[model samples]
Target chain A: MAQGGGRVQRAAVIGCGTVGASWAALFLVHGLDVTATDPAEGAEERLRAFVEGARAQLAGFGLTGSGRLRFVPRVPEALDGAEFVQENAPETEALKRALLAEIDRLLPPQVLVASSTSALLRSAIVADCARPERVLVAHPFNPPHLVPLVEIVAGDAATAARAAAFYRGLGRRPVILRREMPGHIANRLASALYREAVNLVAEGVASVADIDAALCHGPGLRWAAMGPHMTYHLGGGAGGIAHYLAHLGPSQERRWASLGNPALTPEVQAAIVAGVAEEAAGLSVAELEARRDRALVGILKARETVAPDPAQDGTAEE
Target chain B: MAQGGGRVQRAAVIGCGTVGASWAALFLVHGLDVTATDPAEGAEERLRAFVEGARAQLAGFGLTGSGRLRFVPRVPEALDGAEFVQENAPETEALKRALLAEIDRLLPPQVLVASSTSALLRSAIVADCARPERVLVAHPFNPPHLVPLVEIVAGDAATAARAAAFYRGLGRRPVILRREMPGHIANRLASALYREAVNLVAEGVASVADIDAALCHGPGLRWAAMGPHMTYHLGGGAGGIAHYLAHLGPSQERRWASLGNPALTPEVQAAIVAGVAEEAAGLSVAELEARRDRALVGILKARETVAPDPAQDGTAEE
Candidate 1:
């Protein structure tokens, strides 16, 4: 397969929505020839605009791909000469299944096909593909071009490793799941955190703005530097996680037991909507997105300067 | 109350453990005269060392307070002439209750006493104080001199607002809980996130290191910029959060329902301890901490440059 790659020279993005467009931009910025196709009428314009906008951010990472980008109206045409395929169609199972089947029919078995499905399992989605072994899930976080996490779930270890290497080559931190799970790793963690965040707002424990402030200013800052495990390990002081678990495990259990599971009743949802509006104050969604993206860029730059990822530095065990 | 504050000139730190020392460093760096006391042997020496190490980080934010730090062996001496009190006694309820009562006795009713307890409720701890109304919880995240969050809980809105103003004056983001809850805001969210993180390890979905990488690289970066509510609001596209909830709320609920509540069995604890050891590789806890602090300093600097806290600027509604 394209698994025994030197470097993937050509990539096909088989849907030009935001995810696909971002993938296309990332591929282009990494100097890969990209052929992109989306059925929507204005897909080409939107894709081009996204790439244009993402170029400066990608350039900030010192990535300036010189490869050509071609837009095709059909998936089959885009798959021609493609060594890798990234399918980012709608989230509907039947649609993705049918799309993958068609892509499997058009492409050689050597080409790896990755679906950017955040919620679906690889086993469920790959059922229709004749070469299902080559198809896996490679979920990227939102604004995929910027955020460097790519969670990969594969049918086999080799495929997962190959995907990880490819993404790692592109300056992305690819976490390979030993087993496919809903929401994978990061999203599930995010979902867990968000549930509590929603609960806090639902219970009127704090304003949406204050809760957000608490996160960004508190654990969020630390999480940006390290993960929960590492943070706790550090919190354990000199004796480390062993010491922490020995002493603080009960408190952790108590806190976990007390965590809220609030349903998004209409009233709760309305409160959240209103609270978010108040938090946003005068800033529009676009303005907030822009601000978030800018802040993300600054953080990425800072993290790079302070502590480059050990995985990227070839020190971490796969 | 001393909180009728033009500016708080003197503060008492009622313990010299890590939390107390960090608070002392923060107060001293903000130009507040700090009188600190602790019962532990060599407490003064450790406190001085911590402050000396923290000074460099505080200076990065252009904070170099001219206030004097006095190390007293007794709480009465620490409280003498102190305008505000930050009690960081050990987490034992009985100990904190007695210490707080003593502090309350030593000071006038107007001198606000903020306890730095993470677990004990204000109602429980303040019961011993003659002026229970003036005592409140003002919890800071670890390494408080650096991280900008301070979660406050009080019997009344007036005290909460007063504490918020005081914390804000020190350039800390103080989130006031409308009602006291176990783990308060940030810790609850963190515990929620950590529970999922531990589950992933227990279930063997991914390595602890990879999960950490996924977080720091992805959502952690966005979170450092904005919180979950604002993040989803932006995720809703032009429709904002109302649209997001209307469309994605079901998916959120599904994920939350599927969230795991893993018990920290001995085996599970062993796995996490081992996983953290592997993630840490050869780096000692002190080395990891120093690395984390450096990254934090860099991130804090970057955040300051990109998006100064609106709360500090007096833009957001109290």
Candidate 2:
């Protein structure tokens, strides 16, 4: 194990909101000794409930591991004997800098630290910390315990490398960002697509329902297995992605030029809200969430039935 | 079934290419008597091989039926006594217009005539047809037998409605495009996303491999089940999509403004090709395709296991 490395045996989770709680559950399920700290009143009860829900859900992924968990009210206590710290504090720059600085002062520089801030730059988040090299962003998608993307960005190469390794240890797919960018990589792609999706609705190109169908039943299905680049690579036939770029690149650029930039005016918002209501067909948010979660579980399990990632089958190489 | 449709007991598949053969397999599995026609020599051997492969794949979805299939050398012979025609001719405006026009003259005016053109607009393809109202684009994602989306666009309201019903009857999700637009609904959305993906690679923000992981693990997973609008609806924490737009729409627009527009220069193309090769790890295109297909089947079956759509259980009302 390197200076700030090795398999993460003891970890601290600072902040017990939905993201933090999910991270805590994921860590615990992976058999790590965990101490979670959150300043919110009734944090213990809420965190426990969230972890319990996560434990039940983790069973669907065929993951069952026993890891000790403790809830402490103090940052110092949470930092005690921790090998790794995942800071899931609110997405406020100043608050995170101060909190991370405190942890940096209390813990040894060898302990890897990652924040789950979706939008904040990692450098900015660690600006006040004494050992900024040990800090990075380990942003996860919603339902961190389930979805397997952990984007590692902005730290010393070693720290970023260790963070990526740590996440891989947790049976997650970690992607490295070479440079800092707004919304990172995935969100940038998502934002680009959603801009057009919203524009299509505003321009009356298609109803919100049909637009959703255009994705979930269409490109979205392909995307779940292969991404845009790979899908286009396949679309190129025997000549592969090179042929696609040579032949179809112009058409793609033309389509991009025509993409709309719809402003979300009150009327547009109302139209979207009404369209969603009609498409949802009176299904409540909770009902829809359950449905979505169930489908997610099934898809995840189905992917596993085929080829499992070699990393997923072995121990972490931290 | 409407005037143009009557539960479609007899169907014709013109131009026995990959798309045509797959469409034939789907129709046959659904118990429709299919007559396929192609003029290319040895097309019978190729089409049969494709359909046989499709039949094995369709069995994974628990679909099996005895539907007689006939191969003829002439389109007129194939169209004789056929109630529905799915034309998968070459994607040339002139060729498609001539073929569609010929079919229009020979077939009943009420029979639905759909061209499976991925790029050509339906309006242009049907411009020479006598009954233009009966012709439209019924674009399917690659390997139509597996992917469930059938994008219906650029036809009269009644024709679009009936086509949607016909596809739904075949247990496919048919999304209607309100207006004729280049690339249609799904491809336009896909093109928007892919343009950004290529830009990210060109800009060195991320590698092609990391970008693909960013999606297949992140938003792509959610998208497989729910579209972006609805996913954001859930993100609103019970307030639904309207609340999401009111709160987060500005952030989305900001991200959109920052999206890159990189030209697909030669260097960029080479980088993408090499990146894909590294990611592919020497798996042949056919091998990767089979893997993708297996995963797709698993996901489709898994979704069915959870929530059975009521429409999937009943006949379509055209």
User: Can you write out model 1's per-residue Cα lDDT over A24-105, one digit (the tens) per residue?
Assistant: 9999999999999999989999999999988888898798987789999898899999989999998989999999999998
In order, the candidates keep a fraction of the true contacts of 0.78, 0.71
Compute the interface RMSD for candidate 1: 1.9
Q: What is the TM-score of chain A in candidate 2?
A: 0.93
Q: Tens digits of per-residue lDDT for model 1 on B35-142?
A: 998889999899999999998788988999878999988889989999999999889999999999999998988888999999889999998899998899999998
Which predicted model would earn the best TM-score? 1
DockQ of 2: 0.64
Q: List candidate 2 segments past 4 Å from native.
A: A1-6, A304-316, B2-5, B304-318
Number of the top DockQ candidate:
1
